[model samples]
Target: MTAASFTAGLRSALRQRFRTLALLPRLLHSFWQTSPALSAAIIVLRLLRAAQPPLVLFIGKLIVDEIILQTASPAPGPTLADWVESGRLSAVAGWLLLEFLLVATANALARIGAFVERVLTERHDNALGVALIQQVASLDLRDIEASSAQDRLQRARTQRFMGNQLLTSLLSQAQDFVSLILFVIGLLSYAPLLIVLLLLALLPTLAGEAHFNAKGYGLNVSVTPERRQMDYIQIVGSVAESAKEMKLFGLGAYLAGRFAELADKVHRGNRDLAARRTLWGSLFGAIASLAYYAAYAVIAWRALKGELGIGDLTFLAGSLLRLNGLFERLILGLTQITSQTQYLDDFFSFMDLRSTMVAPSNPRPFPVPMRQGIVFDKVGFRYPGKGAWALRDLSFSIPVGETLALVGENGAGKTTIVKLLTRLYEPDEGRILVDGIDIRDIDIAELQHQVGAIFQDFVRYHMTAAENIGIGRVGCLSDRPRVIEAAQKSLAHPLIETLPEGYEQMLGRVFARGLDLSGGEWQKIAIARAYFRDAAILILDEPTAALDARAEAEIFERFRNLSEAKTALLISHRFATVRMADRILVLENGAILESGSHEELIALHGRYAELFALQAAGFQ
Candidate 1:
């Protein structure tokens, strides 16, 4: 590396370390939130344990000193019993007993602290998981769909599982810090020079740890997208959703190879970093150890010269050894914390994101039984990262109590209209008015509550039959009457009743005891959600695409009768289905090419008539 590049790298690492340390306060607040009592208990237990180590070492010094004095004195008795009664060994005996009790107490405190930490770690993990779920739920659809947002979300989710390890490291570091302070205070009375030597010896190790930790974190960040791809491949290989295709196309080996390639790349990066860190760490550790023994020699030499007693020598030697180990531990612990803080950065950054599509402070109330109906007044929109417009100058209206059908090819912006109407994406230009009021002015929740829609690609949730339909109106999930009525409207009641558990039967093959249904049956269940919602305005986008001709006819017939007094919008490619609409609009390139009823459009011989004739001829 060039000198300039090395300087830049050092600056970047220092910045990362400081930034990570800043997150410590936030982590402490999270722990307190998880359980104030547990957090307080952990701190108290660790503090008490920290004081025991230095006190134990001091008791050892006293025991040794008392033993030497007793040995040097004249023999008080000839036997063990006599010696115990004479009081010659009394002082040494008391010191030994005190040391035993201190050691026992330290062991008990250590175990108790571990137990408390385990409980706190579990609670902290669960709390973080819930916070992540809530944060993701509040995001806008566009945010969720963006690639950059997905990477942030993945990093946040991955870091959540590291909460327990991070908590344990933090508590351990706290305990060690207190112990180091007590040890330092004791050594100051004898030789303060040894403390300075210890710091200098460990400086190299500290710098190396900080440097390698930053490199490790960078490696993990770069591999995040590949890691996500590997996980996706694993799911596809094992899940029931792709089981049929996997077997038919013999994709097992191909998927395995793809996963292996990505996994190997990640492994190589980690392996290279680990090798370098281990080499430098060993070299630094050897230097620290040599410095410690050199200090030990000085203490021994002072004792030999009669300047210090054997007790003082023993005490100083033990303190030097412990100080060496403790300081090393403290250094490594600090670096580990700084590293984990990077993960905490991911978690907090994700939580910090706010939805751009927010409701106004004083929003207009949604129209109850919409008066003038919905209108698109010269609305124009282009999807993000796309050069072409999805819709431009799209002007249209659905009058109250009218069933309007829209006919268009696949990319004619039909779905984009639905997304804009529901405020999933805001229009780049112009306004969408609901009951003559701009949709942006209406309360988002209330606006969504008043509209019911079912798209062609509906989710096959792995849940009970009733739950799948009941989720349409979550407030009425327990209303069995409403659920049954909605199912009946979609003609799904008979299919559901035939299941072993009826409405309680689990749907989809993902879970045990789940009974998977045919495409037509699932479509019927999806259609029932719109009925369950019973909103003022309903939209059915290819709602019967999975059904056969007879089933399609039956569904539309029921739809025509049920929606007679409701304001509804329909999108379908089938001319037979669109013929039931009171008004039909043929759309091409997001522009209205023809507008009329079935008979009027057929008579006008426009784009709609041409498509209708072509579809009708296929039936003949």
Candidate 2:
């Protein structure tokens, strides 16, 4: 890039940094409310440190003058003894002592500042983290399933860590820069030419540091895919879903080897970049060191020429050393802020993404009791990137307090139907209605409250058994009696009683004292959760998949009694289990092929008859 372009980019980056800093006050204000005394103390300590450097340099010059006077022969000028008698020497000595005390005080204050800043930053991070997570959890299920959503989530987490570090570094650098400016002024009063030399000395070091930072950020962005792959492998190798299969198939070693290969590639790339950076950094250091010592030599030579004195030499030399240290720290801080800005961009981008499914400007309250049943009026839907529709322009309805069964082959849109009813995804065409009102008009939260659903792939939380069941009902998940009653209704209570801790036992092997339940047992727990909800509409999708013949038979026999007054929709492949439904709908390739009672459909000799006969033939 040309110099002009680079300068413009740097200016833009600085502007962005200012914007982020502008946000810091509101953040700090929040912190102050939480802990006012500590925040005030931290601000005071920073101010004190900012005032210490110039005072120390001024006192050092006076002490050098006093020493020179003490060693000189008595001349026409005021003698050392005369000056002491006049109290000038006493005043200089007192100032030197005070400077020493401030130095010690600054050090103590710095340590306290470090501790307090760390504690407060952590507090802020935790609060923000919780808020962000809550927002993510509230997003529509369809939004979360998008491919780009995971990248946004990863950026948010990384930004939280980098944002804290950037804030602390920026604050510390501001204080140091203020102190450096004052010290430079004191040095200029003694040797004006040294000011120009100090600026020249900082240029090469800053350039070199900026180059290294750019390389690091470029490397991080380039390796994102590799890093993500490595992370995925690690999760699969260690997490519950893959643990049993990994061991049984002896695939652990293979996954570990893949992980190591990616790690090695990352290490190799980093090593090469580091080597190049070290070479350039050393070259810059040599050039800077030459300029620094040359300035020192000129100052020393000028002092010996009788045009300068001992105090002048001491002040000039001390100021040069202090300026170099301050300049280095400032440059490093700038580099850190620049790199962290990219992470901040990623974070804000995630927060800025608009959810595709937005609530209406003024949502209507849902019907209190769902007097009429749900109706899908010519509904259709297609996956985000797929060409074919998962559901076509199909219309269906179920009456209140009735059981409807959906039977279909794999990829026949049966599960997609349930998802739409649960508001997991919005239809591309037409609308679904509850109580003859469009579902979109109702408040989403209220709509969800009235529906309970169990999917083929239900989440098995790594929590206590009671919690697992209680999650079906909003706010009643923790009510012990309600949890037990739900579990009993679903025929899951007997299975829980067999465990060591009964309903309180942890349900996943990842935690200490956790027990992994059988698939059938887990399915029962999921059913219990749905039962616990006590929602007006209940959906069971392949709820009997893990059960044996006897268990499935028993579950179907108790289904009507357990459901009671609620409208139920069951999606299953087993003809025998679905035969008990008041009405059955046969779906094929995103369209309803037939709808009737099982005997009526069988008599039609259509898709339902074909599927039912196939299963019966298997038994024969």
Which candidate's lDDT is highest? 1
For 1-620, candidate 1 gives per-residue lDDT tens digits of: 35686457667887999988888888889889989999999999989988888888888889888888888988888999889889787888888888899889989998998998888888888888888888887787788898888888999999876667778788888888898899899989888998999889998888788888899899988889998899899999999879999999999999999999999999999999999889889998999998888888888888889988888787888878878888998899888889999988888889999989867888998888677888999999898898898899989999888999989888988888888988888899999998899999998888888888999998888999999999999999999999999999999999999999999999998788999999999999999989999998889999999999898999988988998767899999988899999999888787788888999999998888888888889889
Cα lDDT of model 1 overall? 0.88
Error of 1 at 58 (Å): 2.0
Q: Indicate the residue-level lDDT of 567 in model 1.
A: 87
Give the per-residue Cα lDDT of candidate 2 at 206: 70
- Candidate number with greatest TM-score: 1
lDDT of 2 at 506: 96
Give per-residue lDDT, candidate 1, residue 335.
Answer: 86
Worst 10 residues of 1 by lDDT: 1-10
RMSD of each: 2.1, 4.1
Q: Which TM-score value belongs to model 2?
A: 0.88
- lDDT (C-alpha, whole model) for all candidates: 0.88, 0.81
